[model samples]
Target: MSISVHLDRITDPIVAQDERHAGSSVRQPELRVLMATRYGRLGASSRLRLLQYAEPLAEQGILSTARPFLSDNYVKALYEGRSRLPAVLAAYARAPALRAAVQEHDIVWIEKELLPFLPALFERALLGANKKFILDFDDAWFLRYGGEGEAGGRNRLVRTLLGGKFPTLLRRAALTIVANETLRDWALRAGAANVLLLPTVVDLDHYPPTAMPTNPVFTIGWIGTPVTAPYLARLAEPLRQLSAEAPLELLVIGAPDFTLPGVTCRHLPWSEATEAAMISQCDVGIMPLPDDAWARGKSGYKLIQYMAAGRPTIGSPVGANTTIVEDGVTGFLAGPAATWADRLRRLRDDPPRRQAMGSAARLRVAADYALQATAPRLAAAIRSIAAR
Candidate 1:
């Protein structure tokens, strides 16, 4: 019944203690980290945060080499079929490639949702001398399959398969990193001894604020992937009501299927560079989500992107969004369409408040969640686990 099924070297506190004590002031090793990812580039939040930690890790003599497990064809199949099995198998079968990549590194870091197949490969590599394994995830992948509330039907099946594979992988990892307190708690309950909380971070320098455009129309934008595209429907009524009075434009980047009546909708193809630029052009950014378990696992990266771009964000009060948006200060957290409509109207009418909130959001991200500020903590965590 334990969440962790087979983790080695976790039960021995003495080993962790010995590794820490012996390595005190020993000048940490020049670590080479191998990262296994589904996507090859730093496009998504998970990949971006891992990349953000790389520069700091390098400063500490840690070099990271990333090897993407799934190909574009495999990912296309996953989306086209709306199933993860084929993608999962392809990732698992990439163990030979993963093993080859790890030979060039000292440790292996598996990003979220990849544990199902890669764990066996990781275990095989760990048997070698001086090789380490680190597991990183932002969501409760195990609970996604069969956990209670809002998860049903087809989603239940996906969750069940994911949950089964995740624990098996976690049990074999040397250390585990989770994004928030909720996920950390879940990992600990699953018997992951060295679970650490490492939230998603933004590159503050890359997303510096530009002068607000003196446009004739007020724009509200949303940026996310096709997976999260459906939540835009929740805002259809609110956006329609807002557009009834003002020149409100709705710019949706990455959601090809998204459309709204009475509001100007611009769908941009999903590219990291262009998406960031498109998001920067908006007057206000919106993050709307249904209250659900899967949504709760989101690390508020959308809000972080908006904040880093110095855009005031309006988000549904769900999961980490509530924690990121300091309601009424940095941004507003509205529950219903009526409240969403009211906030949009207020921001539309008041330019100064929007400017002030945008400034505050930028400051918040730079201080707490920027890569420069957060990477040290991540490095220290790696150092801790690596020593063990």
Candidate 2:
């Protein structure tokens, strides 16, 4: 309940001292990192963005221990539309654990904060405890406290208390890693002293293209969580029009209820193992996002995954999507409903062009967006911050 109580519950003074001494010890070559992950590996921010650094950084002798605020059970329950009170309490209980883990490490890498919704001042015990804090953000969480995540009702009260603290967290952090340039600018405006842009990337070895589909039916695919499900709805009119003019099918992974009239909509649950195969199944992958501040902060992870799978992507011409899609090369950045239909028609009708784009997409990923390409940069950033 109280700060003292939490510290008393999990604080390990001996371990803390050992960590402090380890920092001065010249014998140790590896850097110990205590990662305050927002969720387990299932969460993209934690998995693709942060956790992927573990193996590569380890090779460079940076060992990391992840202490997740939310558990797998909490994520499963929340996605199922269940009450989040139990999960909230469970996550709250882990705050002290994370604080304790932060003690024996050279650096603390947090996805966001020690806990969301709590007052930003509460961060000092977990972060400001004389540690090199690497605060990583993959989304525009500042909007949540202002409006986005709040659904009115009693949650508004939570939003009010949690409001306006993202800036404070950025300012307090030793280093901030943001997913896009938009968020990096926000962090700079928030007074963050050090910031780095680390967009979401994929391991090509793990997500190489599958055998091209032999079916005559053209398939347009989308993969994301339920919250982004509505983004696909924005394409309904254009997709419906495209289907009427041609034989097109839709596969919605992670959103079971997503439907497009005149198109046969199929759904599949999101699974790490099957996600690559699912992306490969598409003749074209689509990422539709509204052009807004929140959308601008997106890292265009879906587009990268699609490109890595060697499926040409059709993305909204917004934020990082613009840079990743490489319009007319790896994919097209469709602006309006007509543009969406036009690009869909082009990719659908031109097999040679589509195959060329897919090949180029794979090459683009291998060149820039692959985990190997980015991991070294991240490790270098961490090393630079640590030395400072």
Candidate 3:
């Protein structure tokens, strides 16, 4: 139901609050942190926001254990367009166990809510008087309740019941960690008292900057799961236009069956073992998102990956993309409907410029979005919340 957060540097007394072992015997305070994640490792939010923090936090003597509401099977089913009703029901059935597991930990670091699609009253009641919890959000999850688009069209009763869910959780959390300024602003507006902006990051060790591969055709890369593949499809018109004028290859990773009629689209099954290497094969990277509330919540992780791989990026000028790409310096930010083709053309014709931009992009990522740079702060933040 839950995993225990073990502090290797601290004795058991701190967990028990035994003052006798607190003064000198303990090197560091022992704190058990429960990672109440939404989904298992297959979910990017859980993987990047919660699971990846385990090793980094352990380095600072804090051990974190995660218990996801939804299993990998649920995520796999969702990605494959299969029915997830069975998995969803199974997750809801496990809710009580997760609720009961909360009492055993010092702090609960939650990725989104412990349960989704339920009313906030029930979710809060499930948490049950525990104030030692931190909330993390990488997406504008609140938008799903009643903001716009499909969310606004939900059944009136469901919308009324769920619209205030995130705000209620935010106001109660000991701390709130958001992936970008957009999410941070939303949390602040929702009455969150203490908030921290921690962007989605790549481990620099795994994402080594490599020289662009010498290929016969210029390649533009995009990496994302099937759910996000539709965003990449927005560039079809631009890519189609570009393909007509030049030898272009659209390297799509993760979504193995993606295709564009006129463009030479190459699909590679995404694997951790080959992602970095696959990214290296690109001359440039692209993240094309529509301007919308849900899209605005994105952390621009695709651009970060591209930057880390020493490839210049061109992203839709929305949310984190505006901040991640330094316009003309590290990468370009163009409207998906406006200048995508023109921007792609610029990078295609200039090899030297691409190299220079890639270098700049990598440097920017190392300085700000690298996991190594933020791990200490993240550990400290969680430790501080646990101590409180």
Candidate 4:
């Protein structure tokens, strides 16, 4: 679409004439945005929250320049179980340059905290209060700053120094974009002037609902990075039990070496190109998370991806998973007493139920969580913040 046509959809002729009369042109200058994401495309949080919207926002006259704190090498090293001390030091060294870069753009979109381990006061001094920046959070990273049950002296020091940092940033931000209601409520409690609940979404074009592939073995699939791979351990016993009763295999993507003691496992490296098709191969998708502040902050993008692929999901009824899965309708939510094995067995026995739920899950994603559904709102929000 042409820029003029885009402008016409958003701005009426009367408004243009009014602007012209007020000594301003009908055509506004393209809004330049500085996207300070924590990591490059390798990082899922930054990829889903900020980078994915860049092209769509650009088409709407909002151009963004993404500056990642950590490089792709940092992500690669982290995933490969290598020490990231050098990468951390390098990222900290490079962070200060962003303070000066803030003045070059109309609006700054910060993915999370500007500086890790630093107080908000220091960040304020570096960036200043004059520049308008949008603060975004897809996870409750603040929980790391001495949350509940931390008794160590080092934890106390961290809490004292950085506990209030997120609140300060939230209070001062021109707009705060969060991935789920848990984070949104946090921002509101922090006195954020504006809060937008923009869930992490998938591109429907990339994740088209296809007919479920026929497989001799029923596959229970999961995709996540190493940082989140530990959560899969929650399902180990359940999966092991299910493996005996059903012709099942655990298909693990992203975490290639993940395994279970009694269950058969197939691991595959995650690539953007294959993730959608990879998900479609599974009979069911699962996201198991502990019920904690940190887990509650998760955006449930994994569920969204599975739903978009026309696959039924079983997620822990914690955090955004509660909203993403429609319990008995679209997918099942494993509660505290709810056995994961029971849910898996039920879906395994009833292929028609799985197909019905998968179809409903796909429709749910298309309506609320797809990139096509949310991109316009994101672009408009960015434009609104820039205009202020």
Candidate 5:
């Protein structure tokens, strides 16, 4: 299951590796990295953290070669309510091509595993061939397949078959990159010696705030995939109560079919080009989640986007939300379903508080959560691993 890391680099003789960690700085004119993403750009996890690195890393002499297991169209299928078996099979079919291309690269940056629902050892050949590897995670994926969730709890077959691979893969990677402390702690517990906490970020410059407030109604927004649309319902009753007293509207981007009874829900389809502009116009952003293990693994990218757009956010005090939102300073964090209504009312009634918090949010993003702040760390991690 293991081979000399030097085999993949070139025909150079074995170097003096008598005493050093696997990742040591070595000069290579150019480093080719095969980034095997679980899903294409439409996938937030892979898009923000891994795929976005292509151009930036190249400037550092690290060439990125992306091999997405799931096509963007496949995401369209999932939302269309089509059977996923075909797309899942197609991903598996590309295994050989992806594996064949691995040998030519200096390192394989695994954005999640090569394929889902497959045994961990399915990638044994790559390890056997001495391919250098790095693992990255923005979500608590271990709980998705291995912990409590619909995928693991109800679908016993999938849990039985594909669940155990993540821990095995975590232990095998040359280095692990995590988006938050929760996942970093899990990787450390999984026996990952080399782990990096690289938070997911937004390019603040690209998401400049709206020039002026022009919306017909004061908008409280939320953005995410349909799968997470249910969390929006958590705000339905709260928003309904606030709506009775305030001139507010709810914008749910990325979930055109989503509806919240008792609340005015404006569902808009999500597109890369329009995402920033759409979020920038919102007065406040909301991310409501039921306190659960799977929800805890979430990176709160929605909050990051809203904050980058200079919109204050209100989210459940869980996972990265606790760190990203500075409670009353950046945005409000609701403690329970009971307090949701009061929180929404405060933000809606006090425009001054909303504007101040939103400004703080944008400043926070520019200072710490900007892509400019974290991309270099990623380039360094990739460069160091490739050097090994």
Candidate 6:
């Protein structure tokens, strides 16, 4: 069943005119943006955000080109080669291609992960005209070197090499883009200037609400990658208990290894289209996150996706989840396994209420979070930086 809801037409002649005026007034600088990302794929959250800005920046005559530090081919080969020293060195040697690509762009945007090879890439990019560098980081990567709760200190080797590198890297950046106010504040405290708070956004056109299933099963769906797979495993027993009294199905997408007892588990392979289809089929989307430093830096893209698909999302009140979801209005925030069970049971019983909340969630995303609406703000920021 496909629900055909027309999104408000976002093409404003005035907006186009404003973009034209902005471009015409400012000398069309040969502003090329170099995005140095860990994963070079177009599908990742960071790459998507870069595309959102790039498309609009192009409209305003900014030439934005992304040079991903790591390519899928390299990663595939490295993993398939399995920890052989030669294979690892071959991967490390590919950093020069990224440095060469950096020469083509005027502004170098570094999505620096805590990887050893990145500093060399950073140093190489810094060689050319000391190009206007923009540092982008989401999570608390500095704290991630040591295992959580084992707080003596980070590994001596890692600490010696990377402990102080992030601060040094930030000191060199002309501008910075952070995921939220929390990150922005941290950057400021750390003495970084020109910090911009740009939260992760969705391609609303692609993620529109589909027709709702009429005889839909009361399915609690969770969609995430392999890294977050264990969180879904943690949900198994609570879902099992929930299924006892209620007609419940746990739809797990993207986690190929996830399995739950007594619950109808539908495990689908990970694909962009497949993930969207699976999400659209959900009655309620659940994002159960561990309340940790790493999870706090998450921009709540999963919740945004669920809400944009017109599915009421129940997520943990961590990081940007608190900002994205308005409890009982857009979706409920579950504190524990018991809360997760209660929220799932409540939504399962009340289909009409679920539909209403889903409708509200869609409206909320359209108003504030849609890429079409928010793209111009980002474009304006780029223009402002370029003008300087």
**Residue 166 miss distance in model 1 (angstroms):** 2.6
Clashing pairs for model 6 are 2-211, 3-211
lDDT scores of the candidates, listed in order: 0.71, 0.79, 0.82, 0.82, 0.76, 0.68
- For residues 1-388, could you state the per-residue lDDT of candidate 3 as single tens digits? 1112221122222233532333354577666788999998788889888888888777566778889999988989988999999999999888878866787778888888877888778867877885588899998888778744553537677678888888888888887888888887778878887777888998899986688878969999999999899887788888888888879899999998778888898989888778889999999999998888888899999999999999999999999899899999998999945588888899999999999999999999998898887776666566656665
In model 1, the clashing pairs are 4-190, 6-171, 7-171, 145-159, 145-160
* lDDT, model 1: 0.71
RMSD of each: 5.3, 8.1, 6.2, 5.8, 6.0, 6.9
- 1 versus 5: better TM-score goes to: 5
Estimate, for each residue in 1-388, the C-alpha lDDT of model 5 and write its tens digit. 2222211121112222311322446543678988888889888888888888788778667898898888876787887788887887777777777757888887888887776767788876655546778888888777767644553446777678767777788777887878877777777777775676777888766896764366657788888888888888877777777778767788889988888777787878899888998887688888988777767777888998988888888999988789889998999899776687877778776777888888898898887788876665566566555556
Over the stretch 1-388, how does candidate 1's per-residue lDDT look in tens digits? Answer: 2222111223334334533554366676677887766565534744674655677678767788877766566655543457666666776677566556767777788775444433344454443555567788766555545533355325645654443455555666677777666666667766665665666877777786786657868988788777677788898888888788877788888777778777688887777666667888888999998887777777878888888888899999988888889999998999989999999988899989999999999999888778877666556556666665
Write model 4 residue lDDT over 328-354, tens digit each, in one string. 999899965337888988999898999
Better of 2 and 6 by TM-score: 2
lDDT of 6 by residue, 1-388 (tens): 1111111221333333445666365565556777666555523655655755677667756777765555566544543444445544554677657656767777777775423434434573444556677777666654544323243135776556555566666665666677765666656766675666666777788786786556546778788765576777667777888888866677777766677778778887667656677788889888888887777777788888888999999999888899889999999998888888888888888888898999999999888777776676555555555555
Show pairs that collide, candidate 5.
Answer: none
Error of 4 at 333 (Å): 0.5
TM-score against truth, every candidate: 0.83, 0.89, 0.90, 0.90, 0.89, 0.85
- Model 3 shows how many backbone clashes? 0
How many clashes would you count in candidate 1? 5
Model 5 C-alpha lDDT versus the unseen true structure: 0.76
Models sorted by lDDT, best on top = 3, 4, 2, 5, 1, 6
Give candidate 5's TM-score.
0.89
> Of the candidates numbered 3 and 6, which has the greater lDDT value?
3
lDDT-best of 2 and 3: 3
